[model samples]
Target: MEISLNSSSNETTLLADDCWEFIFKIIISDDSCYFKSLSLVSKQFLSITNRLLFSLTISTLTPQPLLPSLFQRFTYLTSLNLTRFHGDLNKLLCQISCFPLNITSLNLSAKFTKSTIPFVGLLSFSKKITTLTSLTYSNIYSIHYTDFIFIADCFPLLEELYLINNLCGSYDNFEVDFSDSFTLYKLRKVRLKRQSINDELLFHLFKNCKHLEEAVILGCDGITDDGIASAISQRPTLKSLSLSDTFGLFSNITTHFIDSLVSLPLTKLILINCCKYSYAGIICLLSKCRQSLQHLNLLNADFLSDQHVVEFSLLLRNLVFINLIGCKMLTESALFALVRNCASLSEIKIEIIWRKSVQNPDSLMGFGVYPQLKSLYFAKSVENPDSLLDFGVYPQLKYLYFANNRWLSDESIIKFASIFHNLQVLDLSNCVRISDEISKLEVLNLSETEVDDETLNVISRNCCGLLQLKLNFCNNITEKGVNRVIENCTQLRKISLQFCDKVHNNVVDSMLNSRPSLRKIIAPHGLDLCDKKKKLFLSQGCILK
Candidate 1:
């Protein structure tokens, strides 16, 4: 590994083998001590070592003392995780991440701590980073749309980009440099997470990114059905669209929108919260995109019935991630019948809480075998003795979420846990029934459950390979559950507790002091508590402005 650094180095004060050992130690142990020791060897050693070590760091724990020492080493990076970075980010932009920002991959999360990267700084970064294929930016503050035009100029060869949860915060108007048309022609996947964009910019992206295979316009409030249809009409290779949480995309005038997708290579559509969509509209959307579609999600807009589901799934023989969570009128045959036809099905989600069927016994009992399924979410399903499916069939099952179910009993959970022997994660949040069986799952998530000390003890005892455990609103839990997690899970990285009312101040301190592996621990949102734990949590990758 150290020999790679010697390729660029002209100096010979530091031996390659000696510097190699320090990084090896840090990778295994995540130890800062080894890194510090290596940096002290010589100026050459310091420069190479810090650049390598800080390439994809959380940046909060990455000391600013190291940046001035290591800023110029940009060639070793492909992915830079700097959203949760500490220190002067805008100034650091002038120093690091951008100046020599010719690296290929960058992930700037929307939850950034500061309003840095003015147009000039971002533009400079884009000029050098021409080899970039994938770009992800989040929490983008009031930077101009023209700023993006500058960045778009750099991504001629770019393929995948995630521009989610950003505010195009500068001037309201944006001008596109159509000087070169095929700027992002090679692009395949694009995710515009929280955008409020106009039709012109949307049109430009669609027209330019003609080769786009999968795109998700998540929460783009400004985009309407007419605008999308018109823009996408020109693109032939477009597929895999997720308009999830896009409430504004719905329209009574659906002719133009429906017509555009009829001959396109469109597949895998998601309409999570289209309030105005009737079953007729859904059927129309499906009739157009059903042939090539393998995955479909229509979460909780409630116009779909068992009849609609049956028709849709028959055409989609390649369906995989089918989620109809909260279609109240859906019968068991709609899912079970569809599962039989969809030989490639892997993940399934529905809205059936802990309550048994008083209205339709046949619908409840009609649920059948999901032999090839891996993950199943009974989103609001209550635990009933007879309403459960045989878990032995789902041998590959990993994650099972039964959140927001209150009628599940202790015995119901034990019986359920007995089924999936290879289960990795299980979420029973809001399952108010007291229980210990769920805690035994490898990675248990009972954030809003009513499990206390005794139940948590079962978790620490049974689930030995557990990596992450969420006890967000489990105020009944004191120290036992936490201690179990700290003692057992050495690979544990994140722990979230947004409204855990029972966690005392000392418990938080002990978690910080004891577990070196704990990278993140979010607590109850109170000003006083936040002030106390601010510095410590910052190192855990939760940056505060």
Candidate 2:
């Protein structure tokens, strides 16, 4: 047992090695940069950090021979991400093959076209790494059906596979008869994007991946409703399904498929941009999967109405995240119902696009509080978002995106700000009704709003912890206001002043001189500034664009 002397207490305490290791693991998982920085602090930290930073990511932009030394240094590396590697990917794989036992997860993003690089050569080395369970191969242009089959045969123990971009060969023309000669029985998850996949491929894929629990098929137009239904219906183990940007295949999800979805113990369902999906089919599906559904995202499902949302909310008590972004038919009434009922609801994204049908402010009279609701994105959705101001309390609320709420009056702003003690990110962009009365926040976006110098000053005073401030097109904010923000918000990292024609170079120069925590400045064009100012900004490591 290792013991450490507490400098402050002047007492020796037993240093729990397991606890320290757990903390270091969390730090590594959260951010690799910070974890690497800590390694350079001291020799003691280096040992711990090396252990925690076991997963290494290398890019082709780096020097050619960077791998040999890195592999030697981090022998414990169990995961590797080879991103945008333009160099000989086969050679890189061969190098990795030298120490194949440790790696469990490998991500390869090849720059070479399929004709130039041999998939066989790459997989030859990858196959040596028996521990490899997860593989993500992206942008490996021109991969045929045979190559995909070969990959499965090579990595029999593979559990997770992500084939992104051009990895699936020709989108328009490709043979479907890839025989079910190989089966990845252990395969649990498969993510396919921008692939030319039809019923035949999915039929074989689902048959082989018997234990498939999660499947994400995005931007694959060749996938028809029948193909998707047949594929998923075969995989009874599947609990989560995300089908986004799939050309009208989802538009007409049949009752048979809906029955299949309901029968599966599905906890998550994300349907985005599949505009053809009938409202009735979705509502019916939701009604069937109500008890099991926990996370549901219908982003850009324009057909969904207020009644559908209300009914869905009523049916599902376990829903934690619900995104109805760009659902033009939905209104505040449905959201109110969810808040009043769904006890586990934590995150919600609703767009009240029907401004003409915007409800009266009085409708928010007895709308109950949602104690679990933590994040809300209502940008450009509501015409009258005054109900949010009146909705008594949301103790856990941290992010509020009420942008384009033109009808949200000054009184509402003040009231909302006063109660949102945990509010960190607020986007009041295009909300002309906003006038001062700001909350202590980390991110504040007031773009195209009627925010003047006085409003900026109010934000500077209250939002001392502000990190990113956007004042784009706010002609009223001059040098004085920006200077006040710079001086007050010491933690400021980024400030956008695009199209704010009134703000000249002098204001930007003054801001740079202040030497606050500013990192990026998206200033307006035609500002008269000396080259010295630009040099000074560069010296301070600030991006002035």
lDDT of 1 by residue, 59-160 (tens): 677777776444454345556676786445445555553445456676665354536334454455566556678777777654444545656675567788
lDDT score for candidate 1 against the true structure: 0.64
- Which residue pairs come into collision in candidate 2? 251-276, 251-277
lDDT of 1 at 302: 83
Weakest lDDT window of 10 consecutive positions for candidate 1: 1-10
**Cα distance off (Å), candidate 1, residue 3:** 24
- What is the TM-score of candidate 1? 0.75
Which stretches of candidate 2 lie above 4 Å from their native place? 1-29, 84-87, 99-101, 110-121, 124-128, 139-142, 166-169, 176-181, 249-253, 275-277, 353-363, 402-414, 427-437, 443-460, 466-545
TM-score leader: 2
TM-score of decoy 2: 0.78
